[model samples]
Target: MIYFYNLLLLILCYLSEINSARILGIIPTPSISHQIVYRPIWKELSQRGHKVTVLTTDPINDSSLKNLTEIDLSFSYDLYNNKHNFSDKIDKLAGKPLEMVNAIITMNADICDEQLKHPKVKRLINDPNEHFDVILVEILQPCMFAFAHRFKAASIGVVSMDAQSAAYDSVVNPTHPILNPDFMLPLAGKLSFFERVFSVVISNVMRVYEFLFIIPINDKVIRENFGDDYPSCKDFIQYLDMLFVNVHPILSGIRPNVPAVVNIGAGLHIQSPKSLPEDLKSFLDNAPSDVIYFSLGSNVKSKDIIPSTRQIITETFAELPYTILWKFEADSLPNQPKNVKIMKWLPQQDVLRHPKIKLFITQAGHQSIEEAIFSHVPMVVMPFFADQEGNAKRIVLKDIAVKVDHKELTKESFKSSILEVMENKKYRENVKKLAELLQDEPMTGLEKAVWWTEHVIRHKGAKHYRSAAIEMPFYEYFLLDVIGFLLLVLFIVIYVSVKMSKLVFKVIFKLCGGEKPKFKRH
Candidate 1:
């Protein structure tokens, strides 16, 4: 009887089906890390029984599986095949990050407007007899904002990186806190007043951008494509209105939340943990000391790294009490050290999870950093560009990591930083404590994300979760004008008090002994 009951319970759990709906996931990741970041959400949505239609670019077409629709943008194909160093061209484009984003938006806008015959976009804007119910959209591409408007599907913006990943960083506020999720991931002890203020400002700006830029563009796209025949853009946008962000509140440093936005940290996306090769496992288990894993992300070529830095690592690992597994792209390291092992590709999360893996010297990319946090492994961060700098800063400031620059990538500095993380033990303890908080949350990142996603779907949109700024202008939403008016009133009162005080002092002096000479009452 007990066995029968247990079997029935298992059957019932397995019978759990998704809310009767299909989710059309539109991700615009032009880079590999971005693709990896979106993977968990993709997997979760699919596992939840939602058939996903994905539209994005991949340099090398990844192996496809059941229930996934992949539309490659070919954003990095030639670059990947040729192994080109063309990134300098993109980075050197002179503009603020927001301006750069605006440029990208306009560029895509121009393509849509100027060349309506383009095959890629024609398919996107094509009229389909069958309609999609919910559209999970990523913000990086900006091209897919038009999809929600055209299809009249519920749309949610999957913010892949920190709040700075969008236009809200320098525009009106700062989302620096969204980087590591702890109060600005303090420089020394805690976030300074200015840092806190900056973080608030970033949050405000992100809210503002979704309002001013994303919404208006989405509306315009729908208006243009459907010729006002489309349904109200507002209904569809705010309807499937969930902000599926890959952020943990603990690492974010701020627990404050906006309605409807699910903070799923890096979640399961970063951890592409695969079973280790038997040979590699044997090698590690046979090793005398703990190991250090080093890799710059996928887009960053280890072979392209200046030979000087490579030599520093090879020699430095030889001196340490540990082995080093460096993920190098090339066939082999020219001057090899016996203590160092080079593999073209290593299972990053799997290596980190190993009991003998002591420390990670990383590029401080958001995904890797979170993986390290999840595994309770400390980091020696060497941020290369963009948000890496911010991520590295947070790790160091949080006392869980020590930051060293690429320019400072010397044997001595690298060895010292690794040794400090290995020997001190506090860094590991601090990271472990944070990992506890991140893990002990009510739900796992993936679970929270899927539940909220289904909630948005079941409710037919997340309009309730939206920030009111979606319908209101920045001035009205933040009530900046009202605040200014109140400040002005306060200034007036202060001025009046000072004047009254002066008058009272003069009257008192005149009444006592000192005469009010050269003074007249008005």
Candidate 2:
């Protein structure tokens, strides 16, 4: 048995070494968790004898992998932008994904427009020797699909965020009929008649400007250096053929049925048998038997947690038998509960999988949900924005968890919700059941993603599934006029029938009156 196992391993490694993959870029946002996700797949690719280039501001920080190229994109992902008080302009779009989408489209157009003109970015674009077999683009919103498209390689887009629009495009969570059901084109769910028309107008305006103005300018710049005849990445969709979403369908069950959009999220278990950080392990050693893992995620700071709400959380735990392990950056809580434990950073997956972890209190981000479900732990979700609300509602609807509002949210509401999940037995059972569903995934999400990514490469770019938005007319694609024509015919037939019936009735009335008036057409 041992000899056969060794032989099989050797054959696998030999096969992998021969398959060299050249990845164009991984544009990761500076979030640590999001970065951790990309790390596994990137490392997997490199292990499988692939060359991976990550284009971002995140430096070569971790010493985990080789065959890597890091492009220092001199840019700030700062969301605050020198504002004194945190702005609500962006936050309000949290659960309302379509609003965030419009913002993304506009922002992407602006950023790309600016970056394409920069000397550094321009130089890279002009380089004739920088060709690659595949360009794996991280979908930096407002649509960076064009970025990979520009590189003249087969393009694949990856989303590493739990934001609604991104998750909606990637995962397929079973919706609760009461709270959430099947929605239409937009991530904000189905739009009204007027809203649909408005979306159409907005989409067209942005697209026309992008194609006519933006694409032409970028194309002209490329032509100035690359060659008048060479095609830009924007026009290379048929060439750029596949996409991989870093979402486990168990957590987010949406699967794009299209052949080109391969979602192999079953690979999340590749990093299984979770381990705890040394420091966090020490903290847990000292804490009580019952510990609830509380975190708002990296983007949203817990110290920024409103004091009024914090008091409610503190009081809620005051009555509970279990202690609270909160992830906060601040040194101290004003009125700390005796059972509460605060930490700057957490070994999240490690802790969630811990035997002592009774309940999870989270922002309900997609990745967080994935970790919790994989760990078979229930949660009390306190979502801030984006798809957080939708995620929160999904779990709550599943009878696996509860959600607390960030706006006008009270401590009493927070306390009661937490108590219910902590004390109630059903929440745990439902969560465990959901966990099993997530667990029984076809394969580990990471392996699925890496395998399919290389498969797309091995097959010379899976071109069959690309939507020809650039080629097909909007009307024909959506079939708007087909339905309109049918309705028009129906209306004309109805009108003709009504007119003939009225004529017949008038003739009958004339006959009953025993008199006929001669009428002539002039």
RMSD to the hidden true structure, all candidates: 6.9, 6.9
Error of 2 at 212 (Å): 13
Q: Which digits, one per residue and each the tens of the lDDT, describe model 1 over residues 364-475?
A: 8778888888889999988655566667876787789998866557888888988999899899999988887777766777777778777877887766665555666668
User: 1-522, model 2: which lDDT tens digit per residue?
Assistant: 999999999999888767786786656354555555666776777766787876664555455667776665545345322221232444556555445545544444444444445565567676767666777766543234445545656777666643223222322222232222222122223446676565555444544555565455545544554457657535543344655656554454443344555565533533556567777777677775678889988767777766776777777777777878989888988788888888888778788878889899998876787788777788888877555665676677778888787766776787788788888999889877877776675567676777778777887676555555425565865678898898999999999999999999898877879566668999
lDDT for residue 387 in candidate 2, whole number 0-100? 55
Error of 2 at 282 (Å): 3.7
Q: How close to the true structure is residue 392 of candidate 2, measured as C-alpha lDDT?
A: 74
How large an RMSD does model 2 have?
A: 6.9
- Candidate 2 local lDDT, residue 380: 88
Residue 69 deviation, candidate 1, in Å? 2.6
Candidate 2 runs further than 4 Å off: 1-18, 57-64, 72-126, 161-240, 248-256, 266-270, 274-279, 467-471, 491-522
How far is 7's C-alpha from truth in model 1 (Å)? 24
